[model samples]
Target: METDAPGEPGPTAERDATIEIDVLVVPDCPNRQLAEERLRQALDETGLRAARLTTRTVTDGTTAARTGFTGSPTILINGRDPFAEPGAVPSLTCRMYRTQDGLDGAPAAARIREALRAAAAAGGGA
Candidate 1:
């Protein structure tokens, strides 16, 4: 029987420390590219260089439901939806974000950065 040494984390603990970020989008979503770029900038700004960022394509309602994808360009941090609002529905349409500048196809850079920071703090991995 092998046990983790004192003051050393086990494999599962170390794996749980990783932050998983997913940008879910549809094939025809125009804002997908911008979302990806913004997410990258946010990751860099938040100093989460080791975080894993993945772009997943959600083609059908079933996939969306399974992926917890609210809509195209939806971002999931650590397997949780940060921008989820009450009454929001999961679909394959392009998602709209309410920014300081009004409605937009994607969330602002500051918002993405804030989400990353919040997720990191909650995960205690920052």
Candidate 2:
């Protein structure tokens, strides 16, 4: 029998090596820096320090729709939007996230970490 130790990566952990992280934002997104910082911290916490990180600029509505960008400062893990709500529509606008305190421009660090872990467990990096 095999067991997964607490806080340790499981079988799919190997996929994390190929994880693709993208931060999408408009030209002048106010939360771009915040989002990037939080994502970096989350990656470190999740032991994905070497994950590939990319930043994309969505300059127009067409680009946003084509790329499935929900809004500026959108973070995609393995090309999936972990925080996306059902029926979310792509837009060229600033995005907001629900946090413990209230609405915020960027997702909390804890939330980003959780999303990364979930993506890793699901072998989404492939």
Candidate 3:
């Protein structure tokens, strides 16, 4: 197999290029900034700094349902919710993530990184 050169795009790089990241939040969501910051850190750590990132506002239940938004500060990796529990339903509310310590408003950077890597590996951008 061909190997990537230094400073060149590797398999992960190619996969990251095709990944799309979306942060869905409601107006005045308290955790939006934290979620965004963690996401940015994860992208940078994963060498996906150039990945497409979009922040969308979910103002109402209609918009939430239309966009498959489970809650405010929901992070979507290639349109999939890697952190969502089974049977999660769209709603206009703040989302919580279960961390090692306890529940938190925003997912940890490591979690985001894992999600990004998984998405890339799974050919999620398609």
lDDT of 3 by residue, 1-126 (tens): 224688998876677678998899999999999999999999888777768899988898888887789888998888888888889899998899999989999988898989987786686552
Task: Output the number of the TM-score-best candidate.
Answer: 3
Alpha-carbon RMSD, candidate 1: 6.4
Q: Compared with the true structure, what per-residue lDDT tens digits does model 1 show for residues 89-118?
A: 778888899899998888899988888777
The TM-scores, one per candidate, come to 0.81, 0.84, 0.86
Clashing pairs in 3: none
lDDT top scorer: 3
| Cα error, candidate 1, residue 81 (Å) | 1.3
Model 2 lDDT vs. the true structure?
0.83
The RMSD of every model to the true structure, in order and in angstroms, is 6.4, 4.4, 2.6
